[model samples]
Structure formats: C-alpha cells, structure tokens
Target: MGEKQPNERLTSWFVRSGWSKGELARQVNRRARQTGAHHVSTDTSRVRRWLDGEQPREPIPKILSELFSERFGSVVTVEDLGLRAVVPVTGAGEVDLPWSGAQTVQLISEYSRSDLMLNRRGFLGTSLALTAGSALIEPMQRWLAPGPSGTPTPILTAANGGEPHTGRLSGPELALLEQTTVMFRQWDAHNGGGLRRKAVVGQLHEVTDLLQETYPQETTRRLFRLTAELAHLAGWMSYDVGMHPSAQKYYVLALHAAKEAGDRPFGALILSDMSRQMIHLNRGEDALELIHLAQYGSRDTASPRTAALLYSMEARAYANLGEVNKCHRAARLAEDTFSDVRTGETEPDWITFFSEAELNAENAHSYRDLAYHSSRSPLYASMAAPVMERAVDLFRVDETHRRSYAFNLIGMASVHLLQEEPEAAAGLAHQAVDIAGKVRSERLNTRIRKTTDAALRRYPSVAEVQHLSDRITTALPEYAAAG
Candidate 1:
C-alpha cells in the first residue's frame, strides 16, 4: 500500500477513447503478441488489474506503452500507463501542426471528431446558449437600412404583376454560389445540420458583403436571393444546434428577403421551414398557422410541386395537432398536386426533391400522426414502416442525412412500442442512439430521448429499456425544467 492505485483513471480514459473493456483487452493482447511476450495474455483479471493501476510484468508493460503510443500517436511509458496521468501542455506548442494536404485532412478529421463529442448528449452538462433574434438583429437591421444607392431593390418580379428578370449572373459568381450551396448541403447531411451553422452563416455574411460592395442593382438583388436561401439554411442549422430562438430570427430574415425579391415560391418555402421548426418545438398551432400562410402566399405563384410541398407540410402540422380529417385532406391534396407534376416541368428550385414517393411518405407521416393521438395506434403503425423505410433508404446515400434517417427510425420505433413490440422498438432505439452519438445534432438527441422515454413507459419491465431511459435522463437536461 505504498501508493494508492487510481483505478478510476483507467476507466475514464477508456470511456473517453470510446473503447469497451473487451476492446482494450484485445488491443493489449495483440500488442503483447507482437512484442514477443508469448506468456502474456489480456485475460479478464489481468485487464481488470491494469484498469486498477497495476502495471503489467516488464515486457507486457513495454508492450502496453507501445500500444497506447501507436494508438494515440504520443509517447507513453510503463510509468505513464501505471500512473494513469496526463501532463497538460499549453497553446500551439503542445500539438503538432499539420502542414501537407494529407496532414490538413487528418487535422480536419480530428476536429470533426472533437466537434461530434461536443454535440453529444450528456457528454458534458454544459449548454450552448444562443438566440437568433439577438444575434441576427444587427445584421437584419443593416440589410433593411437604405444603402448609398437607396433602399435595396428586388430583381425578380411577382408572377402575377410586373416583368420578371431573366438576367443570368456572371458564370464565376453563379458557380461559386452553387458550389457553396452544394458543400454546405453535403456537410449538413453528413455531419448533422447543426455542425455547419457557423460556417454557413459566415459564408452568407461574406456573400451579402460581396453583393453590397460590388454588384449592381439587378445583380445584387439576385445575389440577395442566394444569400437569403443560405440564411434560411443557417437558421435551420441553428435550430438543430439547440438555438431555437436564433433559428426563428433567421427564418424571419429569410422570409423578408424572399418577399423583397418578389419570389413568392421561395417565400413560401421559408415559411414552411419555419412551420417545420415550430412543430419540432411543440408549437403545433403556430406551425399550422404558418403552413396555412405559406399555402395562401404561394397560391398565385407556386409550381405544382411547390404547392404540393406546402400542402404536405400543412398535413404534417395538422397531424401534429391531432386533426385527422384535416391531415388526410391536406395529404390528399398534396398527392393530387404531385400527380399533376409532369416530366420536364420547370419546377421551383426548392421543390425539386418533392417526388411521388416523397409525397407518399408524407401521407404515411400523416397516418402516423393519427396513430399518435388514437388509442389503436398499432393498427396504423404498420402503415408507416414501408414509407419510412423507403425514406430512410433514400436518406442513407448522404452522410449528412444519416442522422435524419436515424431520427426517422426512432419515430418508427415509437410506433413499434405503441404496437407492444418491445424487442423491435429497443433494437431501433439503440440504432438511433448509436447514430446520434456519431453526429452533432441536438434535434436528433431530442428525438432519441423522446422515443426512449415513451418506450420506457410502454415497457417498464424491460431492463435494457430501463437502462436506455436512465442513460437518456442522465444525458439530457433536467427534463421537467426543460419542459
């Protein structure tokens, strides 16, 4: 008992590294064999002893040191392993600076991993406090203010009145805009929408500055439209990042820009997005109102697909409100409008993804909503499976959408739990949680928590279910307080 052992330190390190005890043991055994320690085996007791700060015999200790060094790319010795200590270093001097393209990629990869950890549920108890209304006020005010050339004018004309501008932007500028959109969209799908908010918002600010500084009236107007779209996306990212108020502000500013541009269809899209966010926040009534407003606003100008999307969104809101009849009517209307969408039809840019299959998925969601409010949810639960399965399949092609697909699985699991299928529900719930761990999305975590909570209530006798519930409870904020 010369020096007390630090058993907890080893456990903490293993957890931080995302490794299980078995995994650590396997690595140790592999390293031991490589180091010619034929007698050394990472059995359960030996692993436990090491976790308890008991250094292994000579050769095994060296092997452990080499293993950790290779794994983390840092020097580790028997003393470091036994003491379970880390010497903190300061600033840029502590870490290697990546230089080459490959090194840069590796650095970015590491940063992405750290960012995911930051976004994880219950990883740290700290919360990110951000408000869109406050953060965006200055920028919105600046945009609204009269410039040197007077009030910034819109380029595109209303579908019903005045001539619409068909002027094409410079090739380079348009390409850059498109490229930025693609990159952000890709990042949004792969890393969860929240992770890219800062970068996207920064890009939007830069685009806005560039337009204000250099572009003529007409060009600036078009550029403003692009900026507005980016702003809406940025707001969406904010919402995903748990900054709901900030998201609302971005939506409002985006709506304003769309109106100023006279882009009725685009404006409707922004409103629909706002409604979607409201729904997530449990403001179903507000969401319904916004969706209705979007519908009315786009009626004169929206393409068939755009109209269908608005109708689909309205259906979603109605479903959330437990308005079965209205949800059905809206879903049908969406399908009907979608049927009229023809090949080669010049659809609004925003509604390009609203295909027939996607419309069916919306219908399925509407039914699922009906199930949520009805006592016999199991009857309708099966209907959601095929539709959501298709949606998940489509979503898996892009990494950014994996979290979304995982969320959908959580929703589907809720349906299973409603149907009294605890096993299937647990399986899906576990998958959702695992995927949630990989992304930096508060929204996905929220969804997982909701699903887990519901499952616990439905199947209280299941140990795994209870464990999952406990995990979520420990990870999230104080539920009652947050509510």
Candidate 2:
C-alpha cells in the first residue's frame, strides 16, 4: 500500500475555514439532512480521516466544497479540496445543451431536469464555470444565421414525425401557461427568487415535456416563447439568490429557446439579462459584450422601451468597469430612447415592466457603481440618491414592486453613506430591513448586511446606526449566522 500522506490542500482550506473538525462534520451532516439525504453519516472521525489523506467518498467532497464555499463567501470546488473527480451521477453536469432547432427540446428537457434535481436534493453546488462572452461568439453567429428557407423552422406535423403523445397543447392550455408565467413573474418581483425557483423550474420541465408532443406551427412558436420566458424567469430567480452557475445555465437555455422561437427581441432580452448576471459577478468586460450583442441583434425588432432597458444595462456594465464617460453616454441613450415611448405602442409584456421608474432605478445603480469606482465620487454619489428616491416613490405605488422598492431603498441608503449622512442612511436602511422581512430574497439580505456594515464602520457610535445593526441581525438571522 502507498504510504499515507496528508491532504495538504484540504488541510490548508480546513485550517483557513477556522472550523473544528466536528463542526465541519456537523455542518455537512446538517446540510445533507436538510436536502433529504438522511443516510449520510459524516462525523468528526471521517473529517479527520480526510485530513489524514483519505478521499472520503462521492458526496462528502461535494458537501465539503459547498460548506467551505458558504463559509468563505466565495466559490470553492472539489478540486480545490484535492478530491478525486467522479463522474456526474445524473449526467446533468455532462449534458451538452446545443443552441439550435428541434434539438432545443432535448436541451431544455435535460437542463430543466438537472435543475430540478439540484432544487430537490441541494446535493451538488455549481461547479460549472460561467460561459464567457468570447465563448458566446459561435452560438451568437449560429443564432443570427438565417435559415436556408429564410424563415422559421417549419413546425413538425404528426405525419411529418412529430412525437405521438397524449399531452398535446391547445390554445387554452397555452394561454394558461402564459397567465401562469405572468403570475410567477409578479410573485418573483414581489418576493424574490429563493422562494419559488423550484416552481419555475418545474413549469419549465412541464413545458419541455409538452414540446415533445405534436402541435401546429403557431402553437410551437408560442410554446417555445413560453419556454424561453419561464427559463429566463428561473434564471433570474437563481441569480437573485446567488446561484451564479445555475443561473448561467438557465439563461443560456432561455437564449436557446428564444432563438428556436425566432424571437430576436426576446433573445436580446435574454442576453441582456445574462449580462446583468455577469455584472453582478464582477465580470464587467464580459457583461459589456453581452449587452452589445443584445443591442445589435435586436436593433430592428426591439421597441423603444426594450432598447432603453438594454442601454441601461450597458451603462451598468460600463459603470462596473469604472468607465465614467461610457456609463454616462449609455445612460443618456437609455434616457433618449425612453423618451420615444409613445402611447399605445405594442410592447412585450416583459418589456412593459421597464417603465420610467425602472429605468431610473437602473441608472441610479450605474451612478452608484461609478461613485464607488471613480474619482468623481461626490458627483456620482450626489446623483444616485435622488434618482433612487424617485424610483422608490414610484415603486411604492405598486404593491407588486416591493422588491424593487426595497432594493432602491438600499441604493439610496448607500449613497447617503457616501454623502456622510449616516443618520439618514440608517433610517433608509431600517426601512429596507422592514421591507426585507416582507420579501424573501437572499440578494436583498446580502445588500442589507453590506449597507449595515458600511454604516457601522462610519457611525458606530450613532444611536440609529447601532439600532439598525441590531435590527438587521434579528431580521436576517440566516445571514447573521453565515457571517
């Protein structure tokens, strides 16, 4: 037998984690049970053995990776823990999601199935690296490529080899699906993604299954569009809760569905959404490419509102990269395009949500980013709060936009901090916390902590700051525990 050697990599991470061996085992066991894995029997001895150079098993490596990732507030992987790579159990990790044609059905089915498994089991963490913008070129080219017939793919007829199945979709059934999507979007906007991501994924699965059955050309296009919307929702929800890898997968699936439906405008929206995720992950360059792709691809088909939203996202990406001039330029374009919104124009249901208020909120975020990253901190910071205030006021008028309202409150509070008004910031942060209790979003919770920490750093002696800090701990105990 080979001489036993210590697992230096695992040992280093374990020591850095500052957790007792038993605590590590307990957390892993607790997470396993929480995910319905009652059979896992990890204990301190097993952890000790792993440190002493044993590769414990299949799931321990995965579980440990997740636990450490959560503990450290960043991505940790099995390879980083020096564990042997095992074959993916469900092949979900190995599945190739091609971005074209009838093959899109297979892509949707497989990806949605994998997503459901993760939602149900919570057994695995996202190990897949996000697809970079440069890597998107081939797929983007394929998407923009015109068909040989210069038309949409002809929907398959039963005689022409549509799958013979019982779950055929009717017009009413399709309409119901659309209505359900609207309801889901409202719910997502009001609360957050963590609460109902599974439901969205489940609906995507059902939609994918229905796609396997026969339908007319119009029905097929509608089904594909619905699939795209649902997948995009699922993606956005995943992103909301900090599931970047899963979010990336869902977003790509949405893009594929959009292309399959021959819906360029929707595809642009999906691309824009993906760029937002990349921005959140601090990949601003990649985000810029994505926003540009969305802009160029949908230039003709996108309405004024959609164009404005895309430009707003571009400004956000530029702000993330500290490009103050580019950010302002894009923001102005967004504003100008927004001004062109005339009454009674036909707009997508999704795009209709990006009203003036939403545009203001987004631009505020861009300025906030610039304030953090540029020399004109006072200039950008001063602009952020008022725009955010306008957004918050508008958002408050709609009960469905509580999440947006809460987020804007945080943004305004952050600007207040930059303005040296700790008391005002504390008050706004307190309102955000109150809203946080009503909404269930991890992203919102994280923002509360960050803003809270900033206030504490600046005005720890202030009564309101001290009180707000205490209130945040009570309102967001899960985050407090993680911290």
Candidate 3:
C-alpha cells in the first residue's frame, strides 16, 4: 500500500465540516468537556498549524477526529487525520496491566474497543507469550501476599438502555450472566470459533459494560468473576480459530479480572489456558513455564480435579518437547490424583469438561508424541492404542462433546498407524473426519491432519487411506478460509 499523505485528509475534512480555525479549536474544547478532560486547550493557533499539515500530539488527534466526526455526522478516526497514534509500547517483558481494579477495567475496556475494530492492526495475529514476564513479577508477588488494605473498590450496579442506574446487580441478573456463560460454552465446544467468536466478543462487551455500574462489594466480586470467565472463554474461542495473540490478550484480561476479584483458582485456570495455546503453537518450554505458573498461582487450595487438570497440561507440554520420562511422570501424577476425585466436591463449571476419560485421551496423545521420537519403539504406540480405546469407550454419545470423541478416535488411528495396522487406521481416520464435519474446531482439524499424515505415511498405497488423506487435505482449506 502507498503511504498516505498527512494534512491533505485533515484539510479536506476541515473544508467539508466548513469550520474556521477558531471553530475547530472550540470544537476540541467542547469534546474535551464532554469527555470530562480538564487540561484540554482551546488554541486556534494550534488548529491552524494542523490545517497547514503540522501534526498534533497525543490525544489531540483522537479528540479532533471525534469532533470532526460529530460535526460531519460520520465516522472519523485519528488515522483519517493522517496522524500517527502514539500507542503504548507493548513488549514481551512489559506487564503493562496495572494492579488496580479501575485500572484493570480501563485496560479491558480499551482492549475490547480495539478488538472489535475491523481494521485493528495490532491484534491481526494472536500470542502465547505472557508479555508480562519481567513486568508482572511485582504484581504476582503482590497477589501472593495479602491484598492490600484500603484499596479503592470499584462499584458495580444496574443499568438499562445502556445508561447508568442506581442499584446493585440482582440475583436474577447474576443468574442471567451465569446462564449466558453456560450456553455460549456449550455452543463453543460443538461449533468452535467459526460460529461463536462474534457471539463471545459480544458477551465480553456486554459484561464489560455492566461492570462499569455501581453495586455492593460482594456483588461486584461476583460480577468480576463472571466477566473473568467470559474473557477466558473469548480467549479460548479466539484460540480455537487460530487468533493466537488476541487469544493471549483475552487470557491475560481474564487473569487480571480474576486477580482483581481475589479468585486465585480462576487466575490459575487462565494461565493453563495460555499454556495450552503455547503447546499447540509448538512452544514447549514456554508452555511448561505457563503450567508451572498455574500450579504456583493455585498452590494448595486447588481441588484434586483441578490439580489433575494442571498436571495433564504439564504432560502435554512435556510430550510436546518429546520428553518421554517427564511426560510419563506428569501423566502418572495426573492419573493418580484423579483416582481420589470425590463425586460431590465443589468444582468450577469449567472442570466439568475434564475427568478420567479426558485424562486418558490426554495421556494417549502424550504417548503418541513419545512414539514420534523413536519409531523403533512401537511400544509407545502400543501403549497409546489401548488408552485411546478406553477413552473412546468412556466418551458419551453427545454431539456437544464431539471434539473429544473425534480426537480420541484420531489418536487411536495414529497409534494403529504407528503399529503398521493400515486398515484399522484408515477406518478410524474416516470415522474421525465424519465427526469433525459436525464441529468447527481448528484444534480438532489439527488432530484430523495428524490422522491424515499417519495414514499417508503408513499406507500411502491403500485406496481407503489415500481417499481419507485426500478428503482431509481438501477440507483444511475450507477451515482456514473460515477464518
């Protein structure tokens, strides 16, 4: 693209708005007052320089853009003014998020606005790097210590027609938010990001807006928790369709909201979700670091089921590194912990997704990863096959859990291929693709791709195997295009 010239657009806009330099300055002051800025200037001289192609500084361009937009009765942006926005620099080592309630909310609000922008430049890709590494050390340490006393609390309350109101979020309102979370989660599991991304982002916007209202302290905390879960779900939905960096940002948003709410467990869950993103992107060491961070964040308070889930994540990371012994150790720890899982213990709604069956499927894949390191040791593949078989047996016949069922079959097919059992592998691959057709998960598509690769490698000459491979290869473009 050609570089756009400055002042040309701005001058044209001024002409279109038919405003004199003094009028433009007055407009800036008017906008500043509307937004409650006390330090804004009414400088006709500055306005003249802008019209003559001298670029204005930070926030002035933003304010000016809005003023012209209002006057012209159309959308206008700082970019339309041909001025560069002095965006805050976000680097890998910076923890940019502040450890204050209002600050966290402000961060989320700004992020949501940017994310919803169709032409948003920074979020074009997704991330797994926590970005807050060196920057977050102080905040993490503070979170570990008791929350400071006398911190200003943000009020949460009710609103109608998007206007402020004087009341706390009622029990029914809280229940409604909870139900919304549940419904979106169910749909996300089945159809994945392709179908649910926009809906999830809308949920984030609604919750974020509601969070700006006034409520009692307890209700405020609950609202924070609910918003945190919604942000986490938005992150996962983004990850499912391959919006990696944006996914990481939403995960961080959830982490901040959870921490702000004093919910350490959910914070830990957000870290694990980020770890999952890293592992899928093939950053094994980074994934392991995130999992360890999760464990540390949760510590002794985590339920056995949650701990097992964390350990399973660790196994997946170690498997990504092709570290067989470490993978088995974590896998064994995960399995052993789940053995003591009680039926009636309180658990987060998200934990409902994991159990013995999920653990088995996770372990089976870990072994398959090990098998990849040493094709000579078909024993790894042999071990994976039966575990996957049991996982498939344990899976319920529900389309909502379709990804789970399809992935277990895909894992089984991989093991069979490793064992040089072409016919069985082909049959299973075909079965997985059929199930995948019912879902919108790129992660599932990834497993299907794995199945296709195994089939081609083990029995490229077989008609059934070739047909399945061709089918998978053909469908992936459509999934990518779905983005």
Provide backbone clash counts, one per model. 6, 0, 10
Give one digit per residue, the lDDT tens place, for model 3 in 1-483.
Answer: 654334665776677667888888987888677667768887888877776677776557767755654564333445445566332324544345566677777777766766667423223332223443344334444445444575434332222234444456678988898888988888887766556676677677777776777666676787789888888998897777555566777887788888767788788888888888777767787788888888987987788888888999999899899888899999999999998899988777877788778888888888888888765459898888888898988875555677788878878888888888888888887887777676766567766776776678767899988888777655553433332
Which wins on TM-score, candidate 1 or candidate 3?
3
Candidate 3's error at 20, in angstroms? 47
Clashes of 2: 0
Residue-level lDDT of model 2, residues 1-483, one tens digit each, is 998889866887788678999998899899788767788998889889999999877567767877876776543456556676442323233224554556777877877887667535321225455565456444554666666667555444441355554545678878999999999998998877766778888999999888876666667778889999998998888777666667777787788788878899999988898888778768898789888889888989998999999999999999999998899999999999999999888777887789888999999999999999988899999888788888989988978888888999998999999899999999998888888777667678778877998899889899999999887654564332232
TM-score of each: 0.62, 0.80, 0.73
lDDT, residue 167, model 3: 55
lDDT of 1: 0.61
The order of the candidates by TM-score, greatest first, is 2, 3, 1
Local error of candidate 1 at residue 81 (angstroms): 32
lDDT of 1 at 80: 34
Tell how far residue 448 is off in model 3, in angstroms.
1.5
